[model samples]
Structures are given as C-alpha cells and as structure tokens.
Target: MNVDRRRRRIVVVGGGVAGVEIATSLGRRSKNDQSMPAVILVDRDSAHIWKPMLHTIAAGTRDISQQQTPYLAQARDAGFEYQPGEMCSLNRANRTIGLAPLHAPDGRLLVPAREIAYDTLVISVGSEANDFGTPGVQEYCFKIDSRLQADAFNREVRIRMLQSVAQEQDLSIAIVGGGATGVELAAELMQLTQIAEAYGAPALSSRIRITLIESGPRLLPAFPDDISQATEERLESIGIRVMTNSKVSAATTEGFELDDGPTVTASLKVWAAGVKAPAFLTNLDGLESTRGNQLVVLPSLQTTQDPNIFSLGDCSSLTLSQGERPLPPTAQVAHQQAQHLIRHLPAVISRGKRPPDFNYRDFGSLVSLAEYDAFGSLGKYGLFKGTTIRGRLAQLSHAMLYRSHQARLYGFWRGSLVWMVDRLNMRLRSAIRLD
Candidate 1:
C-alpha cells in the first residue's frame, strides 16, 4: 500500500491552543510535500484566545480584542482551510462528523447543518466548569469558560459599578472555587477595583468587596503548601476575604448557601470550580471515556476504539502505565502533545507507521496574583531539579509564557511587533477597560 501516493484529508475540530498548533503545523508541512494531507481547521468561533487569560479579561484589566487571533487570518497565513461550525456528532462508520447550524445574535440562521469527511480527525475541544448538578449554579453564577462569557462578566461589572456609585452602596462579589482559575480571578478583580479608583472613581476601591470561597482545606492545593499559604496571605493583605473549607451546597438569588447552614451574601456570584468535557462527548460514537467525559486515548493519543481519530488537551485522558493519575489539564501539556503529533502524525498518516508514545515533561506551575505578587517552583528536566521563585522573578517568568505562545503562532517579527504594540497601549490607555 503506497499511503503517501493518496490524497489524505485531515480535519481538526477545535481551535484551542493544541488544535491551532497542530493544524497550522500540519498545513505548513503539507505545503512542501504534495503527498501530505490537506488540513482543515474547524471551530465554533472565528477567532482564538488563549484560555488562561480569560480571568484577566473578566476583571477588565485586559482588552479582549488585542489578545485574540482571527481564525480566517490565521488560515490565510498558515496554509489551511478554515471551517466555522460547532461539532455535534461523530459518525465512525462513515468517517464523517456533523456540524450544527450557525446562528446570528438576532436569531437569524447563517449556516445550515453540514457534514465533513475526514481520513483523520483530531478532537481538542476544551473543558467547561463542572457544576455537579448544584442547584441555582446554572441560573445564578457567572462563569469564565469562553471569551464572550468573560466579556459579559466585565460589562456587567461596569454597569453595577455605575449604579453603586449613584446610590452610594457597597458592591460585594463572591467567587466559589480555590483552584488556579478561581484564585487568579480573585486577585485580578482586586486589581480591577484599584485601577477603577485611579480612573477617578474616588470611592470605588473601598466600596467593592471580594470574597473567595474554597471547598478545599487550602488554596492552590495543587501547589506546595508554602506557596498556597503565601498566596492566601497575599490575597488577605489586598483586602480580599479568603474562606477555606467552606463548601457551598447550593446557590440562591441572594448568595451561596454553605453546607453547614451559613449563608454568604454578595451582589455578584461566580462559579469557578471543577471542570468536565462538554456533555455531548460522553456518548460520542461509543468511544471509551472517563466519568468527566474526557476521551480515553492510548499513549500515542489515538482514541482507543479508532486509530484514525485522536484527542488532545483538556478533552483527552491518558494515564501512563507508570502513573496512577492522568496528566493535568494545562496549556503546557496541550502544547507538548501538539508538538508530539507534529513529529509523528505524518508518519502515521503518510507511511502507515505507528505513532511513538508521547512523554510529557513537567517544568512545574506558576501563579500570578495580579501586580502585587507571583510565586511558583521551576524545575529542569533531569539533574537541575527544582528552583523556587517569588515576587518579581516569578512575575516575569509568568509573563514570558504568554509571549512565548504568541511567538509560536505569529513567528518572530510579527510576535515582536505585538509585544511592542501592547507596551504602547499600556502607556497610552487607562489600565482598566471602561467600555
């Protein structure tokens, strides 16, 4: 079988960090080799924004437009076809997937239901907040799962601030969850309050209050104990209340109902807790999956039931033979997996060869607490081991991660231009978004 002689169609569903990298890399690779597969990148949105920055956007400290990459532009620059739609179903027998109809904000139909065929498929649609069937969560809490959601949250904050200033009333916000997303949001929200005051809202800082509620015994439970302790203390110093081991059994119109019968009241509520894949994925074509609905994949990232289908990032679960737990869902994990596929996918598709097992390299995690403080442990691959960094050094390392990501997607000169523009914007514009 001369696999390289055939024209292969590769369709990637999702435009996340992993999906964009794989699609762009594959498209570029195929351009030089006529025998390689043709790539199509399908996503619900026409633009891509790094998920980790959602908290900053929600806090109004970051502008969404400046950070987002338009998908059509990306395709034109990277040599791939861009299809915009939501993936609704998978047909294994026919090797095709169904996309739901696209609609406009005014309830007008834009695109009809369609199906796309693929010789190979990659699923990278990321996870969403897991409410665990908690009552009122869906109805009451604001979430930061998508770019639109983050923007909406910030807009609401601005509206509420205006009303509070007119009425001379204090505004209260309560966030549920102690994980990275929740912690980062709490810090950023405080920073937003400070910036808001600087913009001439004299009493805004003192009139706004933030309370972080965590079900766990400590914040950032994934990090070292000392780091978590330091983070809590820093948050406390900023006038944000930190509540640990305070599980909320239910949410109400007023606020959250604690498990022990106490109630915490707030003007705005946010749920930033656990995460699970989209509900539709659990039943997709009978593929093996974890309880959280993450597709079970082999070490090579191919779905257990279908060799032509693969999954990565937050949507896939792979428990190495030597490990008791699956890899943590993080940007670095997704980026590394995409790199592995870049190296091996061509061999698997073009030469009928096996994909080498992927090995994840962990360099540790960092937490950014707005502009006040940052801390984390950095570790080298082998002999160098671990090094702890705090304050300024940790803050710089955190910023470098996002810059490196931009460099990957935009190339050197373009990425440098973006950095320069961001610096200029910081000096010219107000720190927080007013519009």
Candidate 2:
C-alpha cells in the first residue's frame, strides 16, 4: 500500500475560495519547477463561483453564467488536476483521502469511488446555514449557500414574479437571517422587482413584499452599530420590512413561526440566520472540531490532530488569543488564509520547512445593497472610526473585492481583461437571466 512518494502531491479538498486559490498558486509553482509537488483539487461541483455573490445569483441581479468560473478550465490553466467528487473519508494514517462515487444528473454512475494519496492535505469545504434544528426548515425554506441553491431560488423567483403579475397579487418573500446574506438578498429582491417591470412585466414594485427577519437587534450585526443602523434604514427606504429581535421557531409551508411572536406567512421563505461547517467535518476521522463541526486549527492553519493536514475558510476555526473568540466565518478570513498558505506552502512542501503562522488582518467590511445603497467600515479595529464609507464609494469598494479575487485566480492582466468584458456585457446583455 506504499504509493510512490517520488512525485509528491498536495490534494486540496473543496473547490472553495481557499482550496481553489491554494491549488492554483501551488500548481503554478509546480508547473515552473519540476521538483515541486503536484496539485490536485477535489470538489463535487464543476464550477467555482464567488461565495459572496450567491445572494445576487438568487435574486437574478447578475448573470450567473458569467460570474461562475469552470473549475476544469481553471485547473488546466493553473497546471493542476481537477477531480470532481466529494470527500467522503480521510485516511490520515495512510496519507490518503477517499472520493465518493460520481453520478450523473440522471442517476447514472460516472466514476467509482477512489482514493488519492497526498503528502499534504488542505480542507476548505466551507460552511452552510445552521437552522438550529428548527422544524420544517429543510422542507419548507430555501438556502442560498451553494450555486445550485441560488440558481434554484432564482428560477422560482422568476416564476413567482410572473404569477404575481397574472393574479395581481403580492409576491412575498420572508428571509430569516439579518446577516450580510439576508440583508443583501432583501435588497436584491427589491431590485429584481424593478428589473422584472422593465422586461414588460406589470407594475410590480408595489406588489412585492420583502421581509427580513433577524434574531439580533440589527442587520449586519458584524458591522459597527452605526453601520448596522444605516443599513437597516436603507433597507426600510426600499420597502423591505425589517423585523429585529424576532427569533424563528420554525419554518412551515405557510411561513416562519416566530417565538413569542406571530407567524409571518409567506410561501417563499429563506433560512440564513447562522452558519455551521458541514456535518461531515465532524467525522473527519478524529480531527479536533468545534461543536459546530468546524475543524479546530492552529495559527499556522494546521489541524491540531495532524500537522500534515490544514484547513481554512468557514470550515476551519482558529482563535489567535485565549478566550478571544474564533474568527468569523467570512470571505475575508478565507482569502487571507489562502494567501498565507500560497506563500508559505511551497517552501514547506518542497524544502520541508515549518509552515509559518497565519495572522489575519481585518481590512474592515463593506455591504453593498444592490444599486440602492452601500456602507463600509474601513481600517483595522475601526481604523480610528473616521475611515467609514457609505453610498457609491462603498459600493465601488465592495465590487473591487471580487475583482481582486478574479485577479488572483486569472492573473492581473487577464483578470483586468475579464473585468472589461463584463463591463461591456452589462451594456449588451439583459441584466437578469430570462431563461
């Protein structure tokens, strides 16, 4: 069972922001140097989309076809192998991982279960919404965590919009979460109503009701108090009902039942309240994990159970100081962790050096609410508080974050060209996907 270690391989599980970036970065190095380890990225999906843009996709604010990058093409360009399947088991002792059998959409088996040997492993499977065992959530509520889920929501929204126009009824959507995803989606749904009207639909603005339910005191709770307040006001300005301190007891086909409150009735409901790593991570063959199923990692991003294995993004939990609280499961944290490994992994894999600790720098957060409004908290730890941005500037900065990610994946010049094409496409193509 001793697989050849002559050509070392680094198998990265999950094609998320962290996993893809690490694969691309390490793959490029091995492409240039023969001694570098081979890079293999494993994922269940064929494409990679920015996790932050899922809400937009669900709302049909942006074109999903253009926003998503095919992982096969990316792997080819970055000089890595893309293995399509989910990680089902980990053989840490054997330095191997097992991939679940691949199946076609029609339930046909395409590939049998297989195992890949790796000298080092990186787990970045990301996370999903935690419904907190709320009854009927899985059956009655929608989630926008993955691209498939987003696209499904989009299709349903388009159908509902048409039905609303025909019946002259209200199109009501209830989102149970006031975090960035919930807040941003509420805004985008408002924009969708407007866009639908432009495509020869009825005067739908007045007929669409968007309700955002938050268990906390305000929306965007991670942002500063003022920023959260401003976002709430902006959302209200757009006709979205903001329900604060309303905890959902369960989601039914009719709507969300609130604890100690009335049940908000709506056919289309979304659960986006809290986040937890995939349940599979908890059984990652004895890896130390949090109660929420996230792998507990050191500052160097190595799992406490095994140094040869590392984790990042939402699926990995790390706290720099004792009792400081684990870092938020955010795109910012994932990007920083990916870059840290990209820079240090080469030396560790090729020259056998100890991986350096990853220090996260919070450059602040920005929330862009479609074309309605935007807000930002710039600088580290408030950056003196005067660095806050709002309106157009904040929206622009928010967009640049996605562009920077593209630049990293495609290289600067190519990424710039892609951006230019997107700008031009906006002018020529329909803003919403009609199909």
Candidate 3:
C-alpha cells in the first residue's frame, strides 16, 4: 500500500469556499506543471453557492441560477477533478476516504460506494444550525442552510403569499436567532413583500408580518453594540417585530412557545441560531473535536490526530489568541485559511517544510438589511483603521464580498462579465424569482 514518494494526490472534500479555493489554486499549479500533485475535489452537491446568500434565496430576493457555480464546470475551468458524492468514512491508515453511493434525483443508484486514495485531504464540510436540542424544532421549524432548503422555503413563502391574498389574512413569519442569517432574512422577507405588492398583489405588504426573535439582548452580537442597535431600529421602522431576550422553549405547529414570554403565533417558523459542525464529523476517524462536533485543528489548520488531513471553514475550530476564543464560523475566516494553505501546502508537500500558522485578519463585518440599507464596523488596521461604515457605502461593500468570491472562482474577466449580466438581468426580469 505504499504510494510513490514522488506522486502526490490531494483530495479536497466539501466544495465550500475553502475547498473550492484550495482545489482551484492547487489545480491551477498542477495544470501547468505535470509534476505537481493531482488535485481532486469531491462534493455532495453538483453546484457551489456562497453560504452567505442562502437567506436571500429563501426570501426570493436572489435567483439561484445566477449564484450557483456548477462543480463539474468549475473543475474543468479551474483545472481540477470533481467527484459528485458524499464522503462517508475516513481510512487514515490506508490514506483513503470512503464515498457513499451516488444516486440520481429519482433515487436510482448511479455509482457504487468507493474509496479514493489521497496523500493529503482537506475537509471543509461546513456547518449547520445548532438547535440545542430544543423540543419540536426539527419538526416545526425551517432552516435556510443549503440551496435546496432555501428554494423549498421560497416555494413555501410564495404559496403562503397566494393564500394570504385569497383569504385576506396576515402572513406571519417568526425567525429564531438574531445572527446575520436571521436578521438579514427578516429584512429580505419585508422587502420581498414590498416587491410582491408592487407586482400585482397590492395588499401583500400590509398583510406581511415578520417577527425576529433573539435569545440574546440584541441582534448581531458579534458586531459592535451600535451596529446591533441600529439594525434593530431599522427592522422596527419597517414594522418588523424585534423581540429581544426572548428564549424559545419549544416550537409547535401553531408557532414558538417562549420560556417566559407569550406564545409567538407564526404561520412560518425559521431557526437560524447557534452553529455546530455536521454530526458526522464527530465520528470522523477519531479526529479530535469540540463539544459542538467541530474538528479541532491547530493554528496550522491541521487536525490534532492526523497531520496529513486539514480542515477549515465551519467544520474546523481554530483558536487565534491567548484567551483561546475560537474563530467565528464565517466565510471570511474560511477564505483567509484557504489562501494560507494554498501558499504553504505546496512547500509542505513538495519541500518537506512545516506548514506555517494561519493568522486571521478581521476586516470587519457588514450586515445588509435588505436593499434599502446596510451597516457595519470595520476593524482597526492599516489606513482604514477604526472606521465605521453605514448606508449605501456599506451596502456596496457587502455586495463586493460576494463579487470578490466570484472573481476568485471564475477569474477576474469572466466574473466581471457575470456581474454585468446580472445587472442587465435585473432590468429585464422581476426583482424576485417568480418560479
């Protein structure tokens, strides 16, 4: 079972921001130099979508087709191999990972379970909402974590809107969690109602009610206090109910039951609270993990149990400073870590150099409260140190993050073309996807 010392094979699992970046970067190198390692990316889904934009899809504010990058096509363009299947097990001793059988949409088995050998493996399987085992949440609440789930929520919203118009009743949506996903979604839902009203359903706006529930005292706890306050005010101004310090005891078909407060009777319920790495990772070949199931990795982004296997994005937990506060599960962290590995991994694999520690720079965070406005504070560093941005500028900056990600994946020229096409499409089609 000995692999050729000269032949290096890198298999990246997850196809998230980190995985795609690493795969494409390595693939680009190996494409030009045949002697470089072979790069293969495996993902359960056929397409990659920016995790940040999932809420917009759920609210129908963004079109799925515009945002999704097909894995097969991206692999071809970026010079990598793409495998469409879920990773089921890790055989570190054999340097192989097991893949679950692939099936068609109609439930037909397409490919039998198999294993792929890798000299090095990068796992970026990302994370899911942590319900904290809250009773009835899994049955009664909706989560906007993936494209399919978001699309399903969009379909549900559209149906409810139609029903609301027919019955002349209010459409109440209760979102649990005050983080970016929940806050941004509340705003988008409000804006979507406006868009729906303008597009022939004039009564829709008045009938739509958005209630954002936060267990904490305020929204966006990660952001500065002022930013959180401003977000709540903005949402309140739009007639969206902002419930602070509200703890949900359980969810029901009718709505959510608050531990100490009155019942929230919502037609639709959404849970967007605490995040935990995928459950499967806890049993991932005895890798050291957090209580939340995130694979515990050193600052070098390599797992404690296996140096050959690296993990990033939400699936991995990394502590930066003395206090040992783990970095937030964010796209920013993932992007930085991916770049770090891309730069250092080659040296480690080819030159027998130790992988350098990854240092994360917080460029600050921006929260887009729908199309009307956005706000955020920039972390103090360089020329723009300690600067706070709001309004249109913040909104534009928020958008540029997604655009930058696209540029990375598709290269500058093609990504710019996409931006232009999307702008043109906005003029030609409905602001929201009707389908």
Candidate 4:
C-alpha cells in the first residue's frame, strides 16, 4: 500500500459513531489547509446508524431506511473518502491495514482485499454482545449487535406476530440480559401489541409473552440501586416478567435454561447480557489489549504500543488513573473521546504538538421503556447531582440523545429539519413494520 506524499493521511477503521465523527471533522478541516490530512473512512457496512437505536429497529419501532445514512453520501457531504470493507488485519510496522473483500447479498465478491497506508490510524470498531460461551447461544439466540441483525430480527418479529395471530396462540419472547438494550427491547416489544391492535389484531398485547432474565440480583447494576428497583417494578407493572438472579447457563431452540433450575420457554430468544470488544482487538498487531479484548490506550487515546495508532469507542480501554476502573462502554464516552481527538488532532498531526490527555465527564444515564415510561439519573453535578427523573420529561430527555447526535453530524438547521420530518412521519406512517 502506498499513497501520494503531498499530504498526510488519516485512516479511520470502523464507521461507528466515534470513527465517523472524527473522520468527518478532520476531513472537513482538510478542505481549508493545503497540508491538511486526507481522511479515509473504512467500514464493513455501506451506511451509518446510531448503534444505541438498533433495538428500536429490531422491535419495529423505527424505519431503518430513514435512520441510516449512506457512507458515500456522508463522505461526499463531509469531505472524506469512504472505503467499503472490513479491516482483516493491521500491519503496524508497514503502517497499513489489510481489509477483507466486499461481497454482494448474493455472495459474489465485488471488491478484492487490499491494504491501505496511513500516517495516522484510528480504530473505533466498537463492541458486540458476549454470550460467555453459553451453550447454544450462538446457534439459537438472536442478537441486535448490528443493523443487519436488527433488520433480520424485525422481519422475524413481523412474521412471528402474524403467525401467532393466525394460529390464535401466544407468542413467547425471552430476552436474556437486563441491560438497557434488553430492557428497552422488552418495552418496545410490548408496544407491538398496540401496533397490532391498531392494524387489526385487538388486544394483541395480552397474547405476547415477554420475559426479561438477569443474572445479577437486580437490573441495571451500573445505575443507582433505586433505579434498578424502580425499573423492575415498572416492567412488572406492565406485565413484563422480570427474573433476577437467574443465570442463563444455556440457550436452546426452545428457550433459556437457568443455571439453578427452571427453563424459560419461548419461541423467540434474544441475548443482550454483556459486551466485549471484537476478539481480533486482543493484542492486535502487537498492540496491548485488555482481557476483554479492548485495546489498551493512553489517556490521550493513543495505543500504548504506537502513538500514531489511536483507538476509542467500546473497542478501546482506558483508565484515567491507576487502580480505577476503565471507562465504561457507552455512547456518551465514545462521543466525548471522538470530540477530544477532533479538538486536538489537527494541531497534533500538523504541528507535532502533544495532544492533551482525554478527560471523560459522566453526564449520567437514561433508560426509555418505549411509550410506557422512562427513567434517568443526572450525573455527578451541582443541584442536579444524582437527580432522578421519569415519565414524560425523562422520555423527552432520552429522545434528545439521538437528536443531539443528529445535530452534531448534520449541523443545527438540517438536524432540526430531520426532527420535524420524524414527527411528521410518525403521524403519517404505520407505527410498526408489517413486512
């Protein structure tokens, strides 16, 4: 792999929130400076979508077509080059990354493997659900770890719902995990009955059995204990069976088998229990990595083994101080890291300046349970310190996370237009995907 020497090149592997954000920012800046770095964004997928919103797509609460932004269009608008392929290997000494071939839906190879040279590399490959080697999890349980998985889940949901209604039988859905994704997904599935009723199947909600299983003693162990208790109460109140302290030892074609005793029976099973970085990130190309496969990075977000190669998002592990816990894998942390790099990388790349140490501020966490309810905790701050909120106000705040990300990516005016379009679309379109 080789490139023109007139300008430095920044290669961003993985087009997730962090990767895309940094690439777009640096790429746009390059438009003004003749010596500015050329940005090349490589991703496995052809488009981008907020990873947090994947569960919504899985539950048919969102339209994938509208939510996704084509990588080509984003690159054209933000002044970057988009390459389609998944990074297969990183060659640190050679300053290049080998990418896998791109293939069509029909399995024909569209582009052959190649290596891309880079002066600087940013890896934000993100994380995926870890089944912890549980038996049958990979074979039987569905996961909403990517857009394609979410789309497939949505199609399965529509088909299953239709079959259940036609057979006049209950559709049992068991979700393993009490994290935000699993909990929020349970809520969204509840909304399906309402959608069905509106479309013809009255009282369909009663026929859909959803059970949420958690190994921990409580749900949302990361949040304050009160939120966990309240969330369980809320879910139970809405007929969502919450099973705590129940470790799923195995997932079968029928459902989850608990370690201690009973087996939960369900036609559809989803695993959202935990997450770990992609296995390849573990000591990848001689770079250090965590036991969970997250890349070990300096506070400045640079990989410990090589300053030129940086990592962020769920794939990177960093602790602000020794003995302290590494930053949690969340959208907020990824966004802040991307912003920190965006703010300092220009000077760092061009003037040989030392990038400032990355400091992450926890703004708190929010959980929205579809239209039924929402909850949140205001982060460590002033009068609002650890403040808790729920209901409509909380729901609105939860919705703002994606909106703010949209505003950041599309600027204020266009983002506002998107918000308006979403509101209009909600009223004019079916609340659920029938196909």
lDDT pick, better of 1 and 2: 2
Per-residue accuracy of model 2 over 106-198 as CA lDDT, tens digit each: 999998999988999999999999999999999998999999899999999989988999999887899999999999999999988888888
Total backbone clashes of model 4? 0
Candidate 4: minimum summed lDDT over ten consecutive residues — where? Answer: 1-10
| Candidates in order: C-alpha RMSD to true structure | 2.6, 2.2, 2.3, 1.7
Count of backbone collisions within predicted model 1: 0
Q: Judged by lDDT against the true structure, how good is candidate 1?
A: 0.89
lDDT of each: 0.89, 0.90, 0.90, 0.90
Error of 2 at 31 (Å): 1.0
2 against 4, candidate with superior TM-score = 4
Tens-digit per-residue lDDT, 1-435, candidate 1: 112324788899999899998888888777667878988899998898888889999998999889899988888887778899999999999999999999999989999999998999999998888889999999999999888889899999889888878888899999999888999999999999888788778888889989999998999988888899999999999999999999899999999999985799988999999988887788799898899999999999999999999999999999988789999888889999999998999989879998999998888789999999998877556554577778999899899888888888888899999999999999998888988
In candidate 3, which residue ranges exceed 4 Å CA deviation?
A: 1-7, 104-106
Q: Per-residue lDDT for 88-117 in model 4, tens only?
A: 899889899998898898999999999998
User: What would the TM-scores of all predictions be?
Assistant: 0.97, 0.97, 0.96, 0.97
Question: Residue-pair clashes per candidate, as listed?
Answer: 0, 0, 1, 0
Q: For model 4, what is the C-alpha lDDT against the true structure?
A: 0.90
